[model samples]
Target: MAATSLSLQIDARWRAATTPPDRPCGMEDIETASSSVVIVRGKEADGSGFWVTPSIVMTNNHVVDHNPDLKVGKDFPATVLATDSVRDIALLSVPNVYPEPVPLRGIEEMPRLADDLYVIGHPIGRNLTVSKGIVSALTNDDYDDRQYIQTDAAISSGSSGGPVVDRCGRVVGMATQTLRGAENVGYAIAWSQLSSHMDRMLKVVEGSSPEERELTYPSDQTEVVAKYYSTLGAGELAEAYDFYSASRKARLPYESWAQGLGKTVFIRLVSVTPGDKSNSVKVHFYSTEEVNAETWEWRTGEFEGTWTLTREGGLWKMNESNIKDITKPTTSP
Candidate 1:
């Protein structure tokens, strides 16, 4: 069946009405944003529980791994679309339409500390519960350089994969972790980090192989792709180059190619099709920059290229010469 467009407003009402009246109330805008939330049910050691959405579910690898019955196929009702152990993020496909799929906004664009935020999910079997609070701090406890969105939003068990919306109802993060000793203190995997994973999933979705019955991408590949965008954020052009194949790096050197380009460039992996043991990856990139001392310029472009890796001295290196056609789209992001 064709997929349906999930509407946030409709889902929000559904969630608000279902939640307990005793909990702190969520904003009207937040209810409108709750349509994307969902309850993920499966038999784990902890028994059955719920999860929320953007249609992208994430949890600690251990939570999922602990449940040996939680196989990617069969037992785990949903598809294990993609996973990134480093970030401890996983993407699952919900066959049914949500009516609304929340968009992931960048971390730099998120609200400041003490700003109000809301967490929507099923806690203790009560689905669609909404918890509200303010950003307490931005901590990088693990030193991943990726800051966790620490908030007082009353997150409890079974809140994983739920939407953490800002006052405006825009999703700024996903409920991922929480502290056991602290009250109402929980952490969310920033939306920016989640987007990087979604981008890779989109590519897999767009480029399904005929022989492959399910949608899945290598965790390592997803990491490389996510890291590539992260590098772009820090203006580390050379580091970003490492993710690309050797030929791509040579042709599109960071310093020379990005010289006139903007400081920030948006990248979306469009698709990844199979190619004789390799893969054909398509990407869409949007860049904005100042053309001169006067005005700024904005451009939307797309790139399509084939990717392959070869083992050299027991190490896999991206084969630069394997890159094929790279196109630039005529639109903007």
Candidate 2:
């Protein structure tokens, strides 16, 4: 009798809609973007991946390269272009072009603790499922320099290699694993850790197949935000700084500007809304870290700012002078 009741309860939840019918929280756009995510099947396991470029998909190395039959760059659905096992990020070239490539956030734009985030993946062999959560923490592997984005977003057996995006619908990390005995604790390879290898990720696909001939890069405004932050997170300071307009960069030289970013542990975009003027975005951020060397304790707080981005030569660049801070600081243990 008890087993029967439990079975019925589980059935009811599954029968519930995978997504809300009303499509709240910009869920509609997120669902559409998820079209880029794909199921990666290997000899030993099945995982998920999303397109980074027209024909190139990014996923976990273990998902496609763990078993003997799933060799990178030689597999059928995707060829492995590059792999960083330490970060668990892999780049692959698919035979076809993907229409929607998810936008990735820069490392320097790390999500703040407790900020709402989401993950889309094929958990437990089911089709795509989007699970939501908050940024729980930023953790590091004791053995290496790699950092992990810890969130409560549910990550199941087959969810590896999925994209974890912030409320702004920007990719911040790649789903990797869940804690063994925990319910909501999951980890992803922060995009910052994957940023440095992006050149190789794109380069490996150049001229490799006829699919490249048909590829087209979309200039979505949100994608620009994603790339800008992901570049910063990956520690490509020069590249990220270049996202600022030439005049802005000149006014705030790299050295002085970078120095102003002192000792940040993590930053999360709490909200991103369109600014008053065209091509402007109002960004609300939250960051957490030690306030001073003497305490060495962690604290979280909110930051509000606006950016005026302009399209130059078919690319977006930030107008840094327009940035403003609207922070509400609070300390928590």
**Taking the tens digit of each residue's C-alpha lDDT, what string does model 1 give over 181-217?**
8787798877666656556654544443322223133
TM-score of 2: 0.50
Model 1 TM-score (2 dp): 0.50
Give the CA lDDT, 0 to 100, for residue 229 in model 2.
52
What is the lDDT, from 0 to 100, of the residue 247 in candidate 1? 62
At residue 223, candidate 2 shows an lDDT of 35
For candidate 2, write residues 43-62 as lDDT tens digits: 77778887665455778866
Model 1 scores worst on lDDT over the 10 consecutive residues at: 1-10
Cα deviation of 105 in candidate 2 (Å)? 7.1
Best lDDT goes to which candidate? 2
Models, CA RMSD each: 15.2, 16.2
TM-score of each: 0.50, 0.50
